[model samples]
Target: MIGRLNHVAIAVPDLDAACAQYASALGATVGAPQDEPDHGVTVVFIDLPNTKIEFLYPLGDDSPIKGFLEKNPSGGIHHICYEVDDIVAAREKLLAEGARVLGNGEPKIGAHGKPVLFLHPKDFNGCLIELEQV
Candidate 1:
Protein backbone atom coordinates (compact mmCIF):
# COMPACT_ATOMS: atom_id res chain seq x y z
CA MET A 1 0.00 0.00 0.00
CA ILE A 2 1.02 3.62 -0.46
CA GLY A 3 2.05 5.89 2.39
CA ARG A 4 2.67 9.62 2.44
CA LEU A 5 3.03 11.60 -0.76
CA ASN A 6 6.71 11.62 -1.45
CA HIS A 7 7.08 14.16 -4.26
CA VAL A 8 5.50 15.36 -7.48
CA ALA A 9 7.76 15.20 -10.50
CA ILE A 10 7.56 17.75 -13.29
CA ALA A 11 9.33 17.52 -16.58
CA VAL A 12 10.88 20.77 -17.74
CA PRO A 13 12.60 21.66 -20.98
CA ASP A 14 14.91 24.03 -19.21
CA LEU A 15 16.01 23.11 -15.72
CA ASP A 16 17.63 26.45 -14.87
CA ALA A 17 14.63 28.49 -15.94
CA ALA A 18 12.26 26.25 -14.02
CA CYS A 19 14.42 26.51 -10.91
CA ALA A 20 14.53 30.25 -11.30
CA GLN A 21 10.76 30.44 -11.63
CA TYR A 22 10.30 28.49 -8.41
CA ALA A 23 13.12 30.20 -6.51
CA SER A 24 12.67 33.81 -7.52
CA ALA A 25 9.03 34.15 -8.51
CA LEU A 26 7.61 31.70 -6.00
CA GLY A 27 10.29 32.33 -3.34
CA ALA A 28 11.03 28.64 -2.87
CA THR A 29 14.17 26.90 -1.78
CA VAL A 30 15.58 24.95 -4.70
CA GLY A 31 18.11 22.24 -4.07
CA ALA A 32 21.18 21.60 -6.16
CA PRO A 33 20.74 19.81 -9.47
CA GLN A 34 21.65 16.14 -9.46
CA ASP A 35 22.34 13.94 -12.44
CA GLU A 36 20.58 10.60 -12.36
CA PRO A 37 22.07 8.80 -15.33
CA ASP A 38 20.31 5.57 -14.55
CA HIS A 39 16.98 7.37 -14.75
CA GLY A 40 18.21 9.58 -17.60
CA VAL A 41 17.31 12.80 -15.87
CA THR A 42 18.91 15.83 -14.24
CA VAL A 43 16.80 16.85 -11.29
CA VAL A 44 16.36 19.78 -8.95
CA PHE A 45 14.23 19.53 -5.85
CA ILE A 46 12.15 22.43 -4.59
CA ASP A 47 11.86 22.15 -0.84
CA LEU A 48 8.57 22.98 0.84
CA PRO A 49 6.97 22.78 4.24
CA ASN A 50 5.03 19.60 3.55
CA THR A 51 6.28 17.99 0.35
CA LYS A 52 8.86 18.46 -2.39
CA ILE A 53 8.53 19.35 -6.08
CA GLU A 54 10.97 17.62 -8.37
CA PHE A 55 11.99 19.42 -11.58
CA LEU A 56 13.40 17.02 -14.13
CA TYR A 57 15.16 17.53 -17.47
CA PRO A 58 16.30 15.06 -20.01
CA LEU A 59 19.86 13.85 -19.49
CA GLY A 60 20.44 12.06 -22.78
CA ASP A 61 19.04 11.57 -26.27
CA ASP A 62 17.24 8.44 -25.11
CA SER A 63 15.91 10.06 -21.96
CA PRO A 64 12.24 9.46 -21.30
CA ILE A 65 11.83 13.10 -20.35
CA LYS A 66 12.96 13.99 -23.86
CA GLY A 67 10.04 12.07 -25.27
CA PHE A 68 7.68 13.67 -22.78
CA LEU A 69 8.98 17.12 -23.64
CA GLU A 70 8.65 16.37 -27.31
CA LYS A 71 4.98 15.63 -26.79
CA ASN A 72 4.51 18.74 -24.69
CA PRO A 73 7.05 21.37 -25.50
CA SER A 74 6.10 23.38 -22.41
CA GLY A 75 6.59 20.34 -20.21
CA GLY A 76 4.25 19.19 -17.48
CA ILE A 77 3.76 16.95 -14.45
CA HIS A 78 5.45 13.66 -15.19
CA HIS A 79 4.59 11.54 -12.18
CA ILE A 80 3.66 11.44 -8.51
CA CYS A 81 5.63 9.46 -5.99
CA TYR A 82 4.20 7.90 -2.87
CA GLU A 83 6.06 6.29 -0.01
CA VAL A 84 5.71 2.63 0.94
CA ASP A 85 6.88 0.78 4.03
CA ASP A 86 8.05 -2.25 2.07
CA ILE A 87 8.50 -2.19 -1.69
CA VAL A 88 8.65 -5.93 -2.27
CA ALA A 89 5.54 -6.59 -0.25
CA ALA A 90 3.79 -3.69 -1.89
CA ARG A 91 4.70 -5.02 -5.32
CA GLU A 92 3.34 -8.43 -4.43
CA LYS A 93 0.09 -7.00 -3.17
CA LEU A 94 -0.29 -4.83 -6.26
CA LEU A 95 0.39 -7.77 -8.54
CA ALA A 96 -2.07 -9.99 -6.72
CA GLU A 97 -4.67 -7.27 -6.95
CA GLY A 98 -4.26 -7.06 -10.77
CA ALA A 99 -2.26 -3.84 -10.98
CA ARG A 100 0.44 -3.71 -13.62
CA VAL A 101 3.91 -2.82 -12.42
CA LEU A 102 6.29 -1.20 -14.86
CA GLY A 103 9.79 -2.39 -15.71
CA ASN A 104 9.95 -6.09 -14.99
CA GLY A 105 8.31 -5.64 -11.59
CA GLU A 106 11.60 -4.86 -9.87
CA PRO A 107 12.59 -1.92 -7.72
CA LYS A 108 15.28 0.48 -8.81
CA ILE A 109 17.29 3.09 -6.90
CA GLY A 110 15.45 6.37 -7.12
CA ALA A 111 16.65 9.95 -6.92
CA HIS A 112 16.40 9.80 -3.14
CA GLY A 113 18.57 6.67 -3.13
CA LYS A 114 15.58 4.58 -2.09
CA PRO A 115 14.08 1.57 -3.78
CA VAL A 116 11.42 2.69 -6.26
CA LEU A 117 8.96 1.15 -8.68
CA PHE A 118 6.69 2.70 -11.30
CA LEU A 119 3.16 1.63 -12.01
CA HIS A 120 1.32 1.87 -15.30
CA PRO A 121 -0.46 5.16 -15.76
CA LYS A 122 -3.58 3.47 -17.11
CA ASP A 123 -3.89 1.51 -13.89
CA PHE A 124 -3.95 4.72 -11.86
CA ASN A 125 -6.43 6.93 -13.68
CA GLY A 126 -4.05 8.24 -16.34
CA CYS A 127 -1.49 9.56 -13.88
CA LEU A 128 1.83 7.79 -13.58
CA ILE A 129 2.49 6.61 -10.05
CA GLU A 130 5.82 5.87 -8.46
CA LEU A 131 6.17 3.93 -5.24
CA GLU A 132 9.27 4.53 -3.20
CA GLN A 133 10.27 2.55 -0.13
CA VAL A 134 10.88 4.75 2.81
Candidate 2:
Protein backbone atom coordinates (compact mmCIF):
# COMPACT_ATOMS: atom_id res chain seq x y z
CA MET A 1 0.00 0.00 0.00
CA ILE A 2 1.13 3.57 -0.55
CA GLY A 3 2.39 5.16 2.64
CA ARG A 4 2.96 8.87 2.91
CA LEU A 5 3.29 11.42 0.16
CA ASN A 6 7.04 11.18 -0.12
CA HIS A 7 7.89 14.23 -2.19
CA VAL A 8 6.71 16.28 -5.06
CA ALA A 9 8.99 16.13 -8.08
CA ILE A 10 9.33 19.29 -10.08
CA ALA A 11 11.18 19.57 -13.33
CA VAL A 12 13.11 22.80 -13.60
CA PRO A 13 15.24 24.23 -16.35
CA ASP A 14 17.86 25.29 -13.85
CA LEU A 15 18.24 23.34 -10.65
CA ASP A 16 20.23 25.98 -8.82
CA ALA A 17 17.77 28.75 -9.63
CA ALA A 18 14.80 26.66 -8.61
CA CYS A 19 16.47 25.64 -5.38
CA ALA A 20 17.17 29.27 -4.61
CA GLN A 21 13.59 30.23 -5.33
CA TYR A 22 12.22 27.57 -2.98
CA ALA A 23 14.69 28.57 -0.29
CA SER A 24 13.72 32.21 -0.52
CA ALA A 25 10.01 31.58 -0.79
CA LEU A 26 9.59 28.78 1.76
CA GLY A 27 12.73 29.01 3.86
CA ALA A 28 13.71 25.53 2.67
CA THR A 29 17.29 24.45 3.00
CA VAL A 30 18.67 22.79 -0.08
CA GLY A 31 20.21 19.40 0.33
CA ALA A 32 23.12 17.88 -1.60
CA PRO A 33 22.75 16.75 -5.15
CA GLN A 34 21.46 13.26 -5.87
CA ASP A 35 22.47 11.66 -9.15
CA GLU A 36 20.05 9.04 -10.47
CA PRO A 37 21.69 7.84 -13.64
CA ASP A 38 18.98 5.28 -14.24
CA HIS A 39 16.33 7.97 -14.29
CA GLY A 40 18.67 10.36 -16.13
CA VAL A 41 18.24 13.17 -13.62
CA THR A 42 20.38 15.00 -11.12
CA VAL A 43 18.30 16.56 -8.38
CA VAL A 44 18.49 18.53 -5.18
CA PHE A 45 16.09 17.97 -2.32
CA ILE A 46 14.57 20.86 -0.39
CA ASP A 47 13.48 19.98 3.10
CA LEU A 48 9.88 20.83 3.91
CA PRO A 49 7.52 20.32 6.82
CA ASN A 50 5.44 17.30 5.92
CA THR A 51 7.17 16.32 2.74
CA LYS A 52 10.19 17.29 0.68
CA ILE A 53 10.39 18.87 -2.78
CA GLU A 54 12.74 17.73 -5.48
CA PHE A 55 14.26 20.00 -8.10
CA LEU A 56 15.18 18.03 -11.18
CA TYR A 57 17.22 18.93 -14.25
CA PRO A 58 18.77 16.82 -16.93
CA LEU A 59 22.35 15.87 -16.40
CA GLY A 60 22.96 15.34 -20.11
CA ASP A 61 21.39 15.67 -23.54
CA ASP A 62 20.03 12.14 -23.44
CA SER A 63 18.20 12.58 -20.18
CA PRO A 64 14.41 12.27 -20.07
CA ILE A 65 14.28 15.54 -18.16
CA LYS A 66 15.87 17.21 -21.21
CA GLY A 67 13.02 16.04 -23.40
CA PHE A 68 10.51 17.03 -20.73
CA LEU A 69 11.92 20.55 -20.64
CA GLU A 70 11.87 20.73 -24.43
CA LYS A 71 8.19 19.87 -24.40
CA ASN A 72 7.47 22.14 -21.45
CA PRO A 73 9.54 25.20 -22.00
CA SER A 74 8.65 26.85 -18.71
CA GLY A 75 9.03 23.60 -16.80
CA GLY A 76 6.46 22.23 -14.42
CA ILE A 77 5.61 19.61 -11.84
CA HIS A 78 6.90 16.34 -13.21
CA HIS A 79 5.16 13.94 -10.86
CA ILE A 80 3.77 13.28 -7.43
CA CYS A 81 5.66 10.55 -5.58
CA TYR A 82 3.99 8.48 -2.94
CA GLU A 83 5.97 6.45 -0.50
CA VAL A 84 5.34 2.72 -0.42
CA ASP A 85 6.45 0.02 1.89
CA ASP A 86 6.80 -2.66 -0.78
CA ILE A 87 7.59 -1.38 -4.24
CA VAL A 88 7.57 -4.83 -5.81
CA ALA A 89 4.08 -5.53 -4.64
CA ALA A 90 2.86 -2.07 -5.53
CA ARG A 91 4.27 -2.39 -9.03
CA GLU A 92 2.58 -5.70 -9.51
CA LYS A 93 -0.71 -4.31 -8.31
CA LEU A 94 -0.46 -1.31 -10.61
CA LEU A 95 0.31 -3.53 -13.56
CA ALA A 96 -2.48 -5.89 -12.68
CA GLU A 97 -4.87 -2.98 -12.73
CA GLY A 98 -3.77 -2.10 -16.29
CA ALA A 99 -1.59 0.87 -15.37
CA ARG A 100 1.21 1.50 -17.79
CA VAL A 101 4.72 1.37 -16.46
CA LEU A 102 7.07 4.15 -17.48
CA GLY A 103 10.24 2.31 -16.72
CA ASN A 104 11.48 -1.18 -17.33
CA GLY A 105 10.48 -4.08 -15.10
CA GLU A 106 13.35 -3.51 -12.74
CA PRO A 107 13.22 -0.91 -10.04
CA LYS A 108 16.01 1.63 -10.30
CA ILE A 109 17.87 3.61 -7.68
CA GLY A 110 16.24 6.99 -7.35
CA ALA A 111 16.55 10.28 -5.53
CA HIS A 112 17.79 9.81 -1.96
CA GLY A 113 18.93 6.36 -3.06
CA LYS A 114 15.56 4.70 -2.76
CA PRO A 115 14.02 2.21 -5.15
CA VAL A 116 11.53 3.91 -7.40
CA LEU A 117 9.36 3.46 -10.49
CA PHE A 118 7.19 5.73 -12.58
CA LEU A 119 3.74 5.03 -13.91
CA HIS A 120 2.81 6.41 -17.32
CA PRO A 121 0.68 9.51 -17.30
CA LYS A 122 -1.69 8.10 -19.90
CA ASP A 123 -2.97 5.70 -17.31
CA PHE A 124 -3.00 8.31 -14.57
CA ASN A 125 -5.24 11.04 -15.95
CA GLY A 126 -2.22 12.85 -17.42
CA CYS A 127 -0.55 13.14 -14.07
CA LEU A 128 2.76 11.34 -13.89
CA ILE A 129 2.94 9.02 -10.90
CA GLU A 130 6.02 7.99 -9.02
CA LEU A 131 6.12 5.16 -6.49
CA GLU A 132 9.06 5.18 -4.14
CA GLN A 133 9.99 2.57 -1.57
CA VAL A 134 11.80 3.87 1.48
Clashes of each: 0, 0
Residue 52 lDDT, candidate 1, scale 0-100? 95
Top model by lDDT, which number? 1
lDDT of 2 by residue, 38-121 (tens): 668898988887898888889866898897899998899989999999999999998899988875767887766789898998
- Model 1 accuracy (lDDT, Cα): 0.94
20 Cα displacement, candidate 1 (Å): 0.7
- Which ranges in model 2 have alpha carbons more than 4 Å from their true place? 35-38
Worst 10 residues of 1 by lDDT: 59-68
lDDT by residue (tens digit), candidate 1, 1-134: 67899999999988999999999999999999999998889999998999999999999778889989999999999999999999999999999989999988989898789999999999999999999999
Candidate 2 lDDT for residue 44: 90
Clashing pairs in 2: none
Clashes of 2: 0
State candidate 1's TM-score.
Answer: 0.97
